[model samples]
Target chain A: MAFLEVASITKQFGNQLVLDQLDFSLEKKQILAVLGRSGCGKTTLLKILAGLVSPDRGSVRVEGQPIQERPLPERGVLYLYQEALLFPHLTVEENLGYGLKVRKQPKPQIALQTERMLYDLELSAHARQLPSQLSGGQRQRVALGRALLVQPRLLLLDEPFGALDPETRSNMQLFFKKIAQQYQITAIFVTHDLKEAVNMGQQWALMEKGQLTHYQQLKDFSKDPKTGLQQEIAFWKKIDHQL
Target chain B: MKSSNLLSIGLVGGFLLAILFLAVGSLATEWRFPALLPERYTFEHWEAWFQKKAWMYYLVLSLLLSAAVSITAVCLGLMTASGLSRDKRSFLWLRLSYLPYGLSPVLYAYSMQFFYHISGLAGTWLGVYLAQLILVYPFAVVLFFTYFDSSMHHLEDQAGSLGASRAVVFQSITLPILRRPVQTILIQLFLVSWFDYGITSVIGSGQLKTLTLIVYQYIGESNLIYSSLASCILMAPPMILWLLQPSRSTKQDIPV
Candidate 1:
């Protein structure tokens, strides 16, 4: 059985249906990138998985246990947003250490882990700075560090690098992949960018108007005409030739 | 001059005029209608006002009442706003929350007189406090509702996902984020209650004397010197608070 199972999730707002009988599953340490246009229920799906929103009907199961009714802490899920959203009141070090502090980890361990994360993210010098003091990329790095320190069962990224410039976005994407692989973190990242989805996810899915279509491999995702990945690749190639 | 410059000058000019009036009114020993200026000035009224032990009591009473009402109103408002912002169904009640603020405080106090009488709260400190709270807490509610926007909800969700209990989320995330706005709102509510005359008189039934009531009484009795002295005393706290407030540029640093 899949390690994380999302079964028949349905959500509606007023007369409009946002998610319709959505079902999917992921194995241990697998990253599933979901690509969708705006208002395609991508955020709604992530919220449901994070337990921020309750589905109209359906359930989520992890390791054969139902987590749909469980509170947030018990679910062990973290959702990272496009905005860095570092707590303005906290320093970079404190923001990174937040989850550990909340989990009541030993002070020394928390300090050691946070310090290591600061160094790894190249934010050691700016550890004492507030969120407002940091550049957009640095803030996002701190947010990622915060999520990782908690050792969540699953990490959900909702276009986490969308706000960054191209260079910063590329750097963050590579850094994310490296850390996720090293830690063997199970994740589902949502993005509108086709290249980002192909680069990050082992399994891919396309969401359109609340329905999800799963692709087993990158080859299938790129080859599928309905997804327009092939056409997109050709357009980029044409630009490359002109350049 | 730019409109902003004009507005600033107007505000400063108004404040200076008020101060000038207070000084002239308090110091003048006698003034005939034919003169623009007072004929004679004396410090005796100020000295006499300061020497009166009862004036101190009135000042202390006003301070305590305003502080209590503002703090209580802010706490209650924060709770109400948090609940209302989180639940879509509760938003319908937000319009109703403004009803108390829409009515004049004296009228609202009059309407509550029957309830206060039955509860034996009429003419009591508790009665006056409740009356001010009804008038001011809604403003706090409205302010907090606007402060705690949709973006704030994301922070709450993020905290919860990080294994924080609800209380932990509030203390660690929400409260800290809200501190500046809360402080601003608290001072505003305090000033609202501090300057109040009608609600206090109506609710306290002219029994509980505050600095405002004293100022009103002196003004009505044509005790202009005493009234101006009391007015000076009454205006001091809010002036200090305004001076101490964060500057406009720094205000943008606050999230909401």
Candidate 2:
């Protein structure tokens, strides 16, 4: 059995069906990039997995144990939004230590772990600054470090880099990859950018109308017309030929 | 001076001049219309009122009533606004919150007087309080509703996901974030209750003699000195609130 199993998840908002019999599974330490356009239930899927929204009908298992009925924090799933929602009142050190503080960790452990996270995020120089004082990339790094310090079983990222400029986005993506590797994080990265899905994910899936199609290989994802990879390659090739 | 600077000085000068006029009016022995200052100034009115202790009585009563109304309204309003922010029927509820303000306060009090009379609350301090609350509670709700927006809810969710319990989230995140807005709304609602006349007159039934009602009494009797004294006293709390308010640069934010 896979490390995480999600089966027959369905959700509806009013008369509109948002998720229709979604099914997928992930191995330990694998990153699944879910590619979809706007209004394709990508956010809903992540929210469901994170236990923020209840699935109308579904079962989710993490490490052979059911988690859908569990309370949000107990579910060990953290969902990151497009914005870097650092607690505005908190300093960088305090924000990084928030997860540990909430868990009622001993003060010494919290200080040690928070220091480590601040160092890892390269934010020690600005530890006393509030969120408003930080740059966009710095804030997002703080947010990511805060989440990683919690050591959640799964991280659900919903277009986390969508608000960043292209240069910042590329840097964040690389930084995320480095951290995910260093920490062996299991994540489902959701994005509308096909290239992001191809580059960031070890496993791949495409979602349309609440239905998800899993791709077992890179070539399979590339060949799938729904992913727009062929069109992307052709366009890049034309630009290359012109140049 | 620049026109803008002149305008600012003019406004402050005008306000101070008005307060001085009231102070002189409260102390005048006899002042004719043409006189710039009082013909003869005396402390008799202030002395006589202090001896009777009537001013103290009304001052304490008004303070207690407005404090109770404002504190209760702010607490209840915060909870109601938080719930309403997530509710689908929020627009309808917010619309209803504005309904009480649509009518004149006196007319609104008259409309609700029957319920107070039947409940045996009319002509009591409680009746006047409930009456003012009818006006101020909804005002508080409307003011606080905008403070609980999508971003605020998102932060609460983020806190919950970070393993903070509901109580922890409220204590650590919600209350701290709401501190400034709560303070502002508390002062606003207090002033609303402090200066209320129409509703208090109708529901208090001449029995609840708050400072505002006493000031109106002096005015009705054409006792200008006592009226001025009471009016000056009535203005003190709000003026203090204004003076105590933080400057814009130093003011802490509330809503995310």
Candidate 3:
């Protein structure tokens, strides 16, 4: 059985269909990148999977257990937004410790883990700084550290790096890849950038009009003409010939 | 920058001058026209006022009423705004909240008095509290509405997904995010209830005597010293509230 399975998820907001009969599955410790344009219902799918929103029809099972009916905290799923939504009032250390604190973990254990995360995020020197005091890249790192500290069963990322500059985004992508491998994180990464999907995810998919098409291999994703990879490559080749 | 600094200093100077005038007027026995200062400054008025002890009772009553009204209004407003902000009909509901402000407080109180009378709450402390709440609750809701934007909602959802339960999210995320706004609204609403006389007089029907009512009564009786004393008393709590306000720099990053 798959580690996470979503079947026939359908949602509508009045006359507008936001998500329609969406289906996907993820194996343990595998990252699935879903590429889509804005208004393609990628966010809605992530929200539903995170249990932040309810679907009119579908079931989500994590580890063979139905999580659709579970409360947000009990579902063991964490959703990260495009912006680094850190608690402005909390210091870096405090934000990193928030999840464990809410879980009623021991104070010493929280302190120990939060300290470790701060070091891992390379934000130990900024342990006392508020979110507003940090740079964009630093803030995003803290956000990721906070989510990972909770050790959620599934992580839903909704274009978390989309707000950063290109250089920072590239660095963050590498950072995420490193941490994801180290922690064996099972996650669904949603983004609009096709190159990002190919770089960041082992499994790839494309979403359009609330419908999803999955590709099991990089070659398959590249071969899919709808991806426009051929056109981009041909344009680059023509430029190379002109040069 | 320089002009703004001078303006701030001028405002503070004006406030201090007003307080000094009130303090001197409260103590003066007789001060004729054109006198720069009172000829005879005595503690006679203060002694008499303290001895009568009526002001103490009115002071406590005013404190209790304002505290109850502001606290209840803020709590209700926060909850209502949270739910209303996410609703499709939020704009309509918020527009309705402003209806009370269209009618003057006195007129609104008089209009609402019938229900109080029929419910047997008129002329009681509860009656006055409820009347002030009616005027203040909607104002609180309007003030708090801006704080519940999409980003705030996203923060709450993120907190929830981070293994915080609803209660935990409220305590940890929502309340902290709302701290500055809540403080601002609480103080503003408290002052609204504190200095209120129109709604109280109309609703209480001369049975309840808040500090504002007593100050007006002293003025009507042509008792300048007593009125000045009452005015000074009335301004004390709000001044203390001002002093207790959090520093501007400390709240620089209050989350929307």
True-contact fraction per candidate equals 0.70, 0.49, 0.74
Model 3 Cα lDDT, one tens digit per residue, B1-256? 6999999999999999999988999999987678888888899888988998778999999999999999999999998998899888999999998999899999989888899899988899999999999899999999888788888888888888888888788888888878877887899899999999899998898999999999999999988788999999999999999988765512335332
RMSD of each: 2.2, 2.3, 2.2
- After TM-score superposition, the amount by which residue B199's alpha carbon in candidate 3 deviates from its true location, in angstroms, is 2.0
Candidate 1 segments exceeding 4 Å error? A233-243, B1-7, B249-256
The DockQ scores of all candidates, in the order shown, are: 0.62, 0.54, 0.63
- Among these predictions, the greatest lDDT belongs to 3
Q: Alpha carbon lDDT of residue A98, candidate 2?
A: 91
Task: Write the residue-wise lDDT of candidate 1 on B1-256 in tens digits.
Answer: 8999999999999999998899898899886677888889999988888888998899899999999999999999988898898877667778878888667888888888889889988899988998898889888888888766777888887888988898999899888778778888888899999999888988798889999898899999988788888888988889888887655412224321
Error of 2 at A89 (Å): 0.8
Query: lDDT for model 2, on a 0 to 1 scale?
Result: 0.89
How far residue B10's Cα lies from its native spot in candidate 3, in Å, is 3.6
Off by over 4 Å in 2: A238-243, B1-3, B34-36, B249-256
Error of 1 at B205 (Å): 0.8
Fraction of native contacts, model 3: 0.74
Q: TM-score of each candidate? A: 0.94, 0.94, 0.94
Cα lDDT for residue A194, candidate 3: 78
lDDT accuracy of residue A8 in candidate 3: 96
